[model samples]
Target: MPVNDTFGDVRITTHRDNDDLLSAGLGLRGLAGTATRFVQPASPTPEELRRRAIQSSWKGIADLGPRGGFGSVYGSIPHVPGREFTSFAYLPGARASHRVLLQVPDEFDHERRCLVVTASSGSRGIYGSIAVAGGWGLPRGCAVAYTDKAGGAGYFDPADRTGVQLDGTRVRAGSAPLEFEPQGLAADAGIAVKHAHSGDNPEADWGRHVLQAARFGLAMLDRAFPHEAPFTAQNTTIIATGLSNGGGAVLRAAGDDKDGMLAAVVAMEPNIHVRGGRSFYDYATEAALWLPAALSARQFDDVPFARVGAASPPAWMLRGAALRAHGRLTSLMPGAQAEEALAMLRAGGWTDEVLATAASSTSLDLWRAVAVAYASAYLKRDAAHMPGGFSYRLQHAAGVAGPIDAIVRAAWWADGSGVPPGTGISLDGGTDLSLDPTLPGVLTLRDLQTGHGADADQLRAAVDATAAELPREGLPILIVHGAQDGLIPVAFSSQPYVKWLRDAGRTPVFWKVPYAQHFDAFLAFADFGDRHAPLLPFGYAALDRAWAHVAQGRALPEDAAVRETRPRGAGPLTAATLSLPPN
Candidate 1:
């Protein structure tokens, strides 16, 4: 089979015996270990990089902690040695390229060929979807395909003249095909991130990238098994699945699958904006503006990461005071102003259940980080051109960045979250030494959302380009989402999309799980684990249902229902903990 015209040179690597495709040779025990270490941190081999990346991505996407029901109940680490094919897919004259990876397990069923196409969740690297899709696909004798969707841990440091190569190695400028290289940058300005600085508005093309990856996966299958010769849609059953942004990407692909390339779609906690639904950036910017002050209320004190009983005024209070001084809040008293802030969020459609887990996002400043990065992408700005002096840099000290370190730069391919504040790199908020650290940057992003100008128009256009429509009629689509997801709340995303599908006379399977929030990885923390159940089990169950419907002709549930889930409070998770519905 000939390689697709859109793909660059394909790179093949074989794994066998001790090494496997799913875990990068790290078995079940290694995956549950405390940390992922490279034998040589300074100069890690390509094999070591792959291992660490697989480990890091698994940790980032799943709940492997003792209380999360990972090893004991649903998850497994199989020894499926196989071949991996990686390539960069790009259209002519495009400056940015999306990474496509196909993993064909040695146990792949030549007779019952199945392909699972996935996109990386959030801004994570190419392996981001491993824990979600690979867990089911590979163990079932199926090949799993993944794409970064033009947003991954590919960071380019203009100052050091280094960028991430397709093989997860660092290369000097112009030495290889870097994932992203901004047109205009200075020697000491900052680092360029693919999701933020690519200038390509990659979100608009996420569906295209997934489709291309699927085609690439089919071609690679033919290349790997010539006796099996041609692998076409007719012989292969294809399922598109993903979580978060990756989930949203698969849904978009299903909508664009007019050629009937996809047999079914299973999206988990997807970041989707249907027609008349509130956009992620719009609500995220709003949350970034109000959450800091709102969480300062006395009620949220017991929530994890909420600053209460601190030596001085907590961070929330300090930021709330700043907001009051800036006239963002009305009441003078801190508690009263906090109440006012909470009321505002409530008025804007945020339920108390969804806001309960917001302390984690607030304490980590995730909302601001996400808003800043997305603002740049929506406006098509690069590192050198970001508003309010916002750019990504390596934080050598508190609230400051120095020269890029060699070791950290080398590991970005494995450790980075395409957005900042991960793998040692952070967003430069351009703070004044005496003021609240993140106020200026937060305000800058909020202004872009609220103000009127060409930039706002441009941002609106970019975001509007990502609005997802219902998939083709009668497609077997299954959507599973956490009812209390703090990040991409169910009300803002899945609920409305389900309604849209119903309004259009389409019936898709939707299972909304209670007590399940986004970021199942957060369940590793003590306080967080005790209160919330891991979303992975339900995701796995959804995959099981989708497979049954596609491969075995099992009927899917017609009406949307709320599945009961029990949180692992003050104990380890057992099978009884998750009351999953029968598939």
Candidate 2:
């Protein structure tokens, strides 16, 4: 058997005029429009699912609004007719399967063969990094490969025993190889997510998954054009790129590439941890415990989604007071309690900019969702039986349990975010066993973090496996990050990682963009767009510089610098808005 035989049941689909690889045929115009809709919400065709998935994934990762400069200055709707090959790659004897997709555009330059491999940014679907990697690779006639890193919108409903297949269709759990199936789900359990319930600690193997995707991409290229015979890393140029978790994945791949499989790497806003850096689960759980209360601080009153005119979220203030009453926070005075909570976070390594951007995440209630899911993964517990009564259930509306929504079930592979509180699945914090309505569940996670028992030991071990190390010596590397990113602050991630690299005698290009934050999708909000610049354009510019240095031996900027960015205030974006640094 061939080495790439691990990529099983390869299914190839050719896309052309009506449905090209880049935009799923939506074109630049359709991509800029509202959300893509299915004719039959309950039973969308495979093609419909692909198109919708592309559009949603693109919009989720890139800023495509009128003033974001997606199609105008930097991006396009190129007709890169190509064949897409999909398959499942797995570890030895592991039941969980990671989705690997390879797209070979018809314009691929065989003589100067190039390939770009990426992992999904978050728990999003396989197309999560399409806007980041695909936007740059396809136009340059490079074959692009993507992997979900075993964390995607693959939802398995224990109630119905159904899950999504590789073809973006539903199938009974046993009918085929679903992406994930909880080992021991209860009879009354609702939905089992792949990333949280797989019991695989998928993040531990993200680097391996990216490497596997690269091998699979090269193997598929060999099959796509047999006349070219063999395609190996030695004969081709392979560049790894991704943002957020995907960025972390590519960095891990570069570190683990002892076989010379990768030539260069560019990671944007990566969620990485070094020896002294903070872990994502640690900060995410901490935020879940205190960010709600921190939002009540008077300083954040003007932040987007933090308050409406003179009124802040009363519930948030209540939660903050509850923390003080529980002795988790200081200051008995209600007005001073919130400010104290903010101080506590700052002492724990949280930056001021991160706290400001967190208001939007708090408004969305994303911290709790992340806390519950990560707790389940780190504790190696089943999501159906999470501690402190945390579980996911199908909800028709807030506080109303119901059967799975037909449309949500049908669109799981495309629209789902691989976490609850999305795609119709809502997180239940176990009836709030305390006076604080929301304190008990989060406190349980905080306790697990502070505990020294086997539970904490296991959690620490799992997180340790996700730590990033210096890449193989002399690999061209570039990192671009938004200074205002709250989710993965540069102080704790890129800053320390870059420092570690330099200490180890490696020079990596690092660009910190001012007035830019994570979640380009949030730019749809006028207030957010007005105050912050999008990171995608800077990401593209970094890719251009990295590619030139990697392929043409161009010298990259040796010193790290903070980029000058001007926020578009109630007006259209212009080149001056980005202030992209010269290469």
Summing lDDT over every window of 10 consecutive residues in candidate 2, give the lowest-scoring window. Answer: 306-315
Please, what are the lDDT tens digits per residue for candidate 2 over residues 1-583? 2354476698899999899999988887788777788898888898999998999899888878887778886767688899999998887645588899999999998878999999999888899899999999999999999999988888887777888877988888878877776766765786788787777788888888888889899989999989996899888889999999999999888888878899889999998888656888888888877777777777886788764322322257677778877888778776788788888899988888778897777767777778778878776667667767788877765555443376778888888887887777778764454545667777777777777888878888888888886788889889999888988888888999999998999888899988788898888788888998888888888888888887788888654454557886787777788888887
- Model 1 misplaced regions, further than 4 Å: 1-5, 92-94, 308-314, 397-404, 558-563
The 0-to-1 C-alpha lDDT of every candidate, in the order given, reads 0.83, 0.82
Predict model 2's lDDT versus the native.
0.82
Model 1: colliding residue pairs: none
How close to the true structure is residue 280 of candidate 1, measured as C-alpha lDDT? 88
Question: Which pairs clash (backbone N, Cα, C closer than 3 Å) in model 2?
Answer: none
Angstrom error at residue 351, model 1 = 0.7
How far does residue 316 in candidate 1 sit from its true spot (Å)? 1.2
lDDT at position 70, candidate 2:
81
* Candidate 2, residue 313: lDDT: 28
- Model 2 spans with C-alpha error above 4 angstroms: 1-5, 308-314, 397-404, 433-435, 560-562
